[model samples]
Target: MKKPFIFIISVLGVILESCYYDNEVYLYGNGSGAVCDTATVTYSATIAPIMASNCNSCHTASSGNGVITSDYNNLKTIVNNGKLLKSVNWTAGAIQMPLGGQKLPTCTLAKINKWVDNGALNN
Candidate 1:
């Protein structure tokens, strides 16, 4: 009885140890461990790609809910209106974006915020 109990406890411990979740920052490091690069963020290279991957699927010209985001001009409209940042940040009074999906990662948000703060230029 003692041996069986000890074996079960050992097995449970192993299982629990193996179930550890990987830290997001560590897994998605920005060159260094657990770092996020907010500097050097560009609209074409950084912001546009993030939008294309995450937003454009639903917010495209024809199918969009009156909120086109497939191109820079349309995207700039939302950014200028403060909807893009508010929605993506999941702030109150703004609809959470990528509906039914998890919020954007912290690093991605930081990059976007940096861009927005820098006048949200077409660069």
Candidate 2:
């Protein structure tokens, strides 16, 4: 009984701890630790860095998931269609992007939301 209980707790612990991630992609890391001020998610300024540092590695113009987020048009298509985030989480957290432990920072997601709210502009 103790073994089962310990195993269950361990699993739950892992699951809980894996709910979020700290470091991955930042829109404009000034090294100033001021990401909160500009998570507006833009193609030229914000989204570029995030997609480049994180998504481009697996989903670029030439390879990976067939994602061409390098340009504003393709990115706009993905974001507007709501497939950008959804595609990354289709595997039930097993493959939640950044290809690692948790997932995107809450702040980063917030920026994306902001961008979405602002009409998913390329600015």
Candidate 3:
């Protein structure tokens, strides 16, 4: 009886231990190990792609609802007015961006903030 009880407990312990969860890379993604290079955030490359993928779908040349995201000069207006970051970051009093989608990824946000902080250059 004692031997049987010990065996069952050992088996349960092994099963429970295998169920442990501490996978940061799996939960948070490989971004934990990968580097996010914000040092070269640029409009033509970084910002354009982000906006094209997330914003331009709705905020285009003629259908932006007064926000023309397809044009760089018009986009600069929003950047200078502080609406870009506020909307993307979901700040109070600012419209939440991407309309109904989940917020942008952390690395993407960092690159955006870096660009904006650097005066939101047209580069």
Maximum-lDDT candidate: 1
Better of 2 and 3 by TM-score: 3
> Would you list the C-alpha lDDT of every candidate in the order shown?
0.85, 0.66, 0.83
List candidate 2 segments past 4 Å from native.
1-35, 38-41, 88-95, 99-101
lDDT string for model 2 (13-107, tens) is 99999976553335434344755644335667887887787677766777756557667788888777777666554445434666564566666
Global CA lDDT computed for model 3: 0.83
Please provide TM-scores, in order, for all candidate models, with all chains considered together. 0.72, 0.57, 0.72
Give the per-residue lDDT digits (tens) of candidate 3, residues 1-123: 699999999999999999875543334432556856777889999999999988998999778888877768999999988888998988998888888898888778888888988998899
Candidate 2: minimum summed lDDT over ten consecutive residues — where? 23-32
Q: After superposing candidate 3, which stretches have Cα over 4 Å from the reference?
A: 1-32
Query: The CA-based lDDT of model 2 is what?
Result: 0.66
Off by over 4 Å in 1: 1-33
Compare candidates 1 and 2 on lDDT and give the better one.
1
Per-residue alpha-carbon lDDT of candidate 1 for residues 2-101, written as tens digits (9 for 90 to 100): 9999999999999999888564445455444568866678989999999999989999988899998789899889998989989999999889998889
